[model samples]
Target: MREEDDKMNEHALNPSRMRGRRNVFCWFYSKCLDAAIEKKWKHWNCAKCEQRHNRQAEPEISLQVNHNIAYYEVSVKY
Candidate 1:
């Protein structure tokens, strides 16, 4: 009871510290997909470090789409 309640509170607070982590990855993945579908190069900066990178010739375009689908599936499952 009380211990379970404390654990729940800890879990709730943990994500606030991890805010924007998932969004950054999702945004980057989507930008890469869009670049591939449009046949153009896209650039992205790291959310944490601001390092620039380009999506010029990714070999796993299909894998990115599959990953996005899997993420959605997991969200729905939970």
Candidate 2:
């Protein structure tokens, strides 16, 4: 029981070393507006999205790509 607890604690402390280390996924969201008319457009699954999907299954790993900026957001729900 103590060993199990220690393992769990280690995992919680070092998530990057946890089992099944996977690549991190990233996507970009952009907005464009028209000068003449007031309108907003949303583009889903852009090149970045597709690339992220093709990377890997694990989330702890990192991918190599050339891009301007990358951002990640977390979500939690009960």
Candidate 3:
């Protein structure tokens, strides 16, 4: 039982959070937004990055949006 708890703890997180950041960062949120749309998911969350995105709340609002910012964010971050 303890081992199970430990495993869950390893991947657990608050309903909303940012992995290494105190706040939700833009790029990760944007990417997660894209993924949620692609997969037709209402929401998407990445435990590793601790980014949770809601497709409807993001700019993937059924319009052509520039991903340049997200790209730049990734390049600068990485």
Candidate 4:
């Protein structure tokens, strides 16, 4: 039990001692989300959402996507 706890603590402290850990998957996902946000914000044409926005002219974009972008922006800074 003591040995196992020591190993776990060592693992936790190693990352802090080193540079840091990067989740490539999450980083890519956030980049894609940022692109989507920029596209929507710029009123650029999106293949999936292009026609939908054009037809309505005034439509509510997904709040969840926007929220995720906001969260990612804050996270990537630090």
lDDT of each: 0.36, 0.30, 0.43, 0.33
lDDT of 2 at 14: 21
User: Which candidate leads in TM-score?
Assistant: 3
TM for every model, in the order presented, reads 0.19, 0.16, 0.28, 0.19
Query: Which lDDT value does model 2 have at 16?
Result: 21
Deviation (Å) of 40 in candidate 4: 0.4
Write the residue-wise lDDT of candidate 3 on 1-78 in tens digits.
465346335653333233232224433354445555676765444654433332223453456546655443334554
Could you give candidate 1's per-residue lDDT for residues 5-78 as a string of tens digits? 46434542111212233233332444434443465434332344221232433455465444535544334554
Ranking by TM-score: 3, 4, 1, 2
How close is each model in CA RMSD to the real structure?
A: 18.1, 22.0, 15.4, 21.4
Model 4 regions more than 4 Å off:
1-26, 41-78
Per-residue lDDT of 47 in model 2? 28
Model 1: lDDT to the true structure: 0.36
Q: What lDDT is reached at residue 74 by model 4? A: 36
- True-structure Cα RMSD, model 4: 21.4
Candidate 2 clashes: the total is: 4
What is the Cα-based TM-score of model 1?
0.19
Q: What is the lDDT of residue 56 in candidate 3?
A: 28
The ten-residue window of minimal lDDT in model 3 covers 14-23
Off by over 4 Å in 2: 1-24, 27-39, 47-58, 61-78
